[model samples]
Target: MEKVNLVFGTVYGSAQFVAETLTSKIAELDFETNLIQSSDLTGFVPKEDELLIIVTSTTGQGDLPDDIAPWFAEMKSAAPYLPGLRYSIIGLGDSSYETFCGAAKQFDELFAELGAKPLTARLDIDACETMEPETDAVQWISTWHSAAQSLNQ
Candidate 1:
């Protein structure tokens, strides 16, 4: 079975919750899924066959959440080539902020810089627009799921 690494970075747990919710949906599509916290990725790198799904929330002044900052910094310093890796991102933020979804945007750029292929466009869930981010994320995942499957063929 294909595998999916559902990685998350959360401030007040919204991103974590969204990641968890997506896990089941991913499984329903017949992909084996693993839930990973961004902070725990010390020497981790996604294998070519593995799909990376990042769900992150921006924090203070458009900064990455504390748990993910170190990992992001490490990746920036290392700049590992990942041309074979495919990934997607879901960002949670309030549009009222000057840098809404900034952390996710940063991740998107970093992944691209490292040569990872994006499975689909990033999903940015605005706190001001929706009370339930998971709903919007779930809807987006259907499209993501299709895109990922196409990669196998």
Candidate 2:
């Protein structure tokens, strides 16, 4: 089975919680999984054939979190060719913010610019709606995985 790499960028830690839940769920699906903060991008890179899942939150009026901004900045500056990457995103933000899920949206665009393909539509969860993050992700992840698996064949 291909490994699943889960990355998160969070200000108040909600994204991390979501990532953990996703990691557990993905493992239950029998995929080897690793959950890490966006800052840990240096630790590993998802191969062209692996699945990448990103969970990020907009911080301080649509900015990346402190721990992740630097890493994302590096990625933007470096802009490594990643035409082979297949990924999905779950962006967490307050709908009240003008830039709801801004960070995640930014990354989604950046990934495309870097030549990565989005395996599915990015899931935008509005915290302002009192949505349950874990529950939403659990359901979405299952559906996303099913879609990815089918496409893989």
Candidate 3:
């Protein structure tokens, strides 16, 4: 069975909740899902057969959550190779900010630069006041799984 890993860097717990809900939905679809905090992804890379879903939130000035700053730095600097890996990103931010979901955007670009293929288009969710991140995440993952299955055929 293919696995889908959910890595989260959340502030104010909203992003974490979003990640968990999405992981649960993926598991319901029969895909193995691993939920990991961004701080704990050291030396971690998804297997070629697995997919990675990064759920990250923007902080002050559109920075990554404090817990995930190190991981972001390492990915940007070391550029650890991930071949044959497919991934996607969901960004949580306030649209009121000049750089909404900027952290997720950066992560998406970094993964692309490192040669990881995106299994789905990135979803940038505005804060809860305007849009529901959880709902968008669920729909996006469903679409991603279907696309991935089709691609594998």
Candidate 4:
């Protein structure tokens, strides 16, 4: 019965949609889900019973979305000290861009640096792909959920 936190760092709102879907799916699996933007992460840390899921998109020239800038910096510096922060990530970007899914990659690296264990591999989606966003998210979540079930043990 642990809480699941779905954090979004979105630019064009695509990432937000993915976060919402993730929240709903987690709820269906019987876990409490808190949907928040990455900006809200500053100074607020979840407890050990919480699971964090990040959905982020790379903005212009591979920058994080406006809201996540501050949190990103703090997390980068503080990650190594974080306690019991198990997490997963889904990054959206256009592979055609020079920095494909840069934001997602950054967060993944930060979480790893901070000692957070990933429930699943970071799922990276290319914007130019023919697959719909929802489909990609659903696929990733299905795999993630299976992996996450073992996390609370």
* RMSD vs true structure, all candidates: 1.0, 1.5, 1.6, 1.8
Q: Candidate 2 lDDT, tens digit per residue, 1-153?
A: 778888888888888999999999889888889887665676354678788898988988788887778777877888888998989999998888898998999999999998999988999998877567878888898678887788659
On TM-score, the candidate that comes out on top is: 1
Per-residue lDDT value at 33 in model 3: 89
> Which segments of model 2 are wrong by more than 4 Å?
none
Off by over 4 Å in 4: none
Best by lDDT: 1
Candidate 2, after superposition: displacement of residue 85 in Å?
Answer: 0.5
Span of ten consecutive residues with least summed lDDT in model 1: 37-46
lDDT by residue for model 1 (1-153), tens:
899998888999999999999999889988899998675687777787799999999998889998888888888998889999999999999999899999999999999999999999999999999989999999998799889879869
Query: Clashes in model 4: which pairs?
Result: 79-114, 80-114
Sort by lDDT, best first.
1, 2, 3, 4
Poorest lDDT segment (10 consecutive residues) of candidate 4: 74-83
lDDT string for model 4 (2-110, tens) is 7888888887788899899888987988988999866568876645568888889899888889877788887666654655777888899999999999999988888
lDDT of 3 by residue, 1-153 (tens): 688888899888878989999989888888888998766787676676788889999998989998777888877888867768899899999888898999999999899888899888888988846456788788787688887787669
Give the Å shift of residue 37 in candidate 3. Answer: 2.4
